[model samples]
Target: MQHEHWWPRPYRFDALLAPGVARARDCAGGIIVVKQGGVPAPLLRLRHPHLAAVVAADCHHHVLAWAGGVPMARLAGRVPVAAAVRWTGQLLAALACLHDAGVVHRDVTAANAMVVGTDAVLIDYGLAAPPGSCAVAGTPASTAPEGWRGHADARSDLFAVGVLLYRLLTGRHPFPGPPFAALQRILHGPVAAPSTQAPQCGSAFDPLLARALAARPSDRFASAAAMAAALDAAQAAFKLHCAANGGLARVAGECRKNGNRNDKYRERERKYRV
Candidate 1:
């Protein structure tokens, strides 16, 4: 007699996407990922354009609809300000939707964010929970100060966004060191302005980052939508300042043109399902 299996039927394992995660192809040849963990209760029905879709779930493992792309971790410290602004906006929108559903991602790190063509998709809901859930879970470097205290909320995710944006802009973590050292710095050390390391960022991002990375959650943007709007305004101001100084304006313009071309290319790729 054939033995029983752990994962559900109608799905065959194709390849290992990572440790504890495997890519599984459905009967119709659609790609999905089976992750070795329980789906957080709060996110069982959560869905958003920028978030990876959950297809099925059980206590032992959960499957997510797959999107082909590169992880943001691989592109860390190399993303241009123009691209960073766009991608960050996408992430914020995802967070806003999650927050509206009364869920907090808890862990929003570079590895969890993917760049699919010209769009950004937030993936991996393994650490997601409702706001005010007391648990310390997430990548050490990206965890907020409040996270260290066993408290997590929407604003805590915003702190991680600040760290991610800082890395994209400056090409380095705001607090760099071993995991423990980084935690100490996050809890007590001061973060430098992004422009100090990346002159291209200019002063426009200084205040915005300060507010996002603030040690106190109350001092940060009230919500993800608010932070997204601030990022848009800051990018516009930075472009204007660059134009006045005759510095990065040309580069920004070139990036925008290239972005448009990329969007068209992505649309074609989607049409062909490439």
Candidate 2:
């Protein structure tokens, strides 16, 4: 199994027949081989822009899949604003599709994302589970609060998307720390405005980011589609804001020039009178 990631894949394998096998390696472990054989029936039937199709998988030791291009983590800061927008749309839509298919990705980190040309695909399903399962599965930085209660639903995955969003826009995790400390911050710390952490960020995202990072699931956007819509609107507003600021600066510059001219005229009159 050739893998760009020398770590455990997100989707659990060899588990239906033996439930805990993946938990040990998939939960807190690293570098899982992406190999060939028995993909689950539900996964095979699923179709989403951000998802890597499961080609085959047996009960326990195997799954051959076609995941997309380079890991998103590698291309984080390198992605252009325009390309990031496209990726965001695909990612949210794909997540919505996955939820619609009755699956919860649980793990939605950048390393699990692959950018193949114009498309970005989410990979590593080994830690994934059906919605409502309490057992822990996901990286510390991206896990939702509900995960601590041993329950993660569609919204749980949404939380991870929020984290991914923060990373994509700022190239920094909303919560940064070692594994345990990171999870702690997620559970207790207040979420900050993205602009506060990254001054270059547009303020239009403040409200949307707040909702996405809400501590309670109900407080967050109802679904991935809804979040995507909000983001679209915010991005639009951001552009408008930038345009307005540019206009204001230009006007200010003109006013300053006019004032300078007036000052010069007043000085000339005083000298002539003398």
Candidate 3:
């Protein structure tokens, strides 16, 4: 008897189930494979128009295999500052695209976000409903505290992006505690700044994060584009500052070289030109 596997393949398999690896399952869906024991290998058997069943050797890509590569949580910890900025910025951009398409990704968290190489891709569509299907799946920390429920709007997606960015910066969830209790607090209380948890960030990022996590959706940035623009500007400002500092150092070096050359030339002229 053949073992049963559960894998769902939709329009396009543009996702990297794992890092540095790509799996292709043709038109028909693919099989969700698993090993019986010992390190747990996978038998991802998918139906191909040409090849009847393409079996992958020593590959694990079951429904659960979505998390095949690195644990996103750990990646968050190991990522350097620049990479985190890029990852969060990309997430915000993806959210903007979804909003432009009139699709609301109610569930947006770090776990649903896959870190492929240096880029971040948003995943998990279980809660992805159309404009108004009335399925609320977003975590509380990613939602407005009051008078905002029912299927979620573009603003909802923005809120989630804010939460994601907060986590990347602080290495902690903005809404922490038991799921139920934490959700309740997020609904009522303002999300504390990442600086609160990561004082190393100082107060520079506090306002930026707070504005994104505002309780009143209206109070928050108008759209994902706007939020992304703000973040981009902040990153640009930092880069510009660094460039200016580097330029200053270069100029100082040139001045020192010229000063030393002038001193030597003057001494030589005094001794020989006279």
Measured by TM-score, the strongest candidate is 1
lDDT of 3: 0.54
Q: Candidate 1 has what TM-score?
A: 0.85
- C-alpha TM-scores of all predictions: 0.85, 0.73, 0.61
lDDT for every model? 0.78, 0.65, 0.54
Candidate 3 local lDDT, 105-201, one digit each (tens) = 6777776677754456665443544555554455555655532457467777777777777776566788888878777767766578765665434
- Runs off by more than 4 Å, candidate 3: 1-71, 140-148, 236-274
Cα lDDT tens digits, model 2, 53-90, are: 65445544334345336776765534433455567778
Report the number of the highest-lDDT candidate.
Answer: 1
lDDT winner between 2 and 3, please give it.
2
Q: Which stretches of candidate 1 lie over 4 Å from their true place?
A: 1-8, 247-274
Which model, 1 or 3, shows the larger lDDT? 1
C-alpha RMSD values across all candidates: 6.1, 14.6, 15.2
On residues 1-274, what C-alpha lDDT tens digit does candidate 1 reach at each position?
0111245688888788688899888899888878765666545577888898767776666778875888877666554566778889999999998899888888899888898887789888777777877878888888888887788899999999999888776668899988888888898878888877766557889988999999889999999999999998999888876877676645444434533223343333343221
